[model samples]
Target: MERAISASDANQRFSELLREVAEGESFTVMSRGRAVARVLPVDRAREQRSIQHLLKFVAALPVRHAGNWSRDELYE
Candidate 1:
């Protein structure tokens, strides 16, 4: 579950918040009683590897052209 914290409190305890996030605790920053932002840890290396894999997969896809057909033929 994400903990809700006021924006002022978040700013006042930024370092503490970072430590909590590093320890896997998540938080949502609130402004005017409305959620505004989230703080969480991320695995940069894993994200980059995933993106690279996606790029390679897309690059290997075959490119094909539609055979000669009129707009009306497509609708039919």
Candidate 2:
């Protein structure tokens, strides 16, 4: 659940908010009853998961052995 906090209050307790965010807590900053911003932890695990998925995708691609053609032959 996202906690609602006023902009001014959020500014006053930014440090405490950061601590909560680090612990997986999310907050929505409101301005005049409208949500203006969100404070959440960086999704480091999601990034790692994406990289792992990409590695698996690459590994599944067909492998090709090195060809004997000279590098300059194609340009000649």
Candidate 3:
């Protein structure tokens, strides 16, 4: 579960909070008692990008680059 902290507290403990986030802890930064932002591990962000890249890779089909094969050649 994500930990919750007030915006002010987040500001005060920003460095430590960043360390915690880097270690895989998540947080909900609250403003006026309402959640305003979330902090997540960097790995999660990388994973999201990798997943998106993989999805695009599969969706594009014919997994090959143009270094040795041209696009038109794929149909031939």
* Model 3 agreement with the true structure over 14-69: per-residue lDDT tens digits: 99999999888999999998999999876777899999999999998976765777
lDDT of the candidates, in the order given: 0.95, 0.95, 0.91
Candidate 1 stretches greater than 4 Å from native: 43-46, 53-76
Task: Locate the minimum summed-lDDT window of 10 residues in model 2.
Answer: 65-74
User: Residue 10 CA error for candidate 3 (Å)?
Assistant: 0.4
Candidate 3 ranges beyond 4 A from true positions: 44-76
As for candidate 3, its clashing pairs are none
When sorted by TM-score, best at the front, the candidate numbers are: 1, 2, 3
Q: Which scores greater on lDDT, model 1 or model 3?
A: 1
Model 2 clashing-pair count: 0
Tens-digit per-residue lDDT, 10-38, candidate 1:
99999999999999899999999999999
Q: What would the per-residue lDDT of candidate 2 be over residues 29-51, giving only the tens digit for each residue?
A: 99999999999888999999999
TM match of model 1 to true structure: 0.62
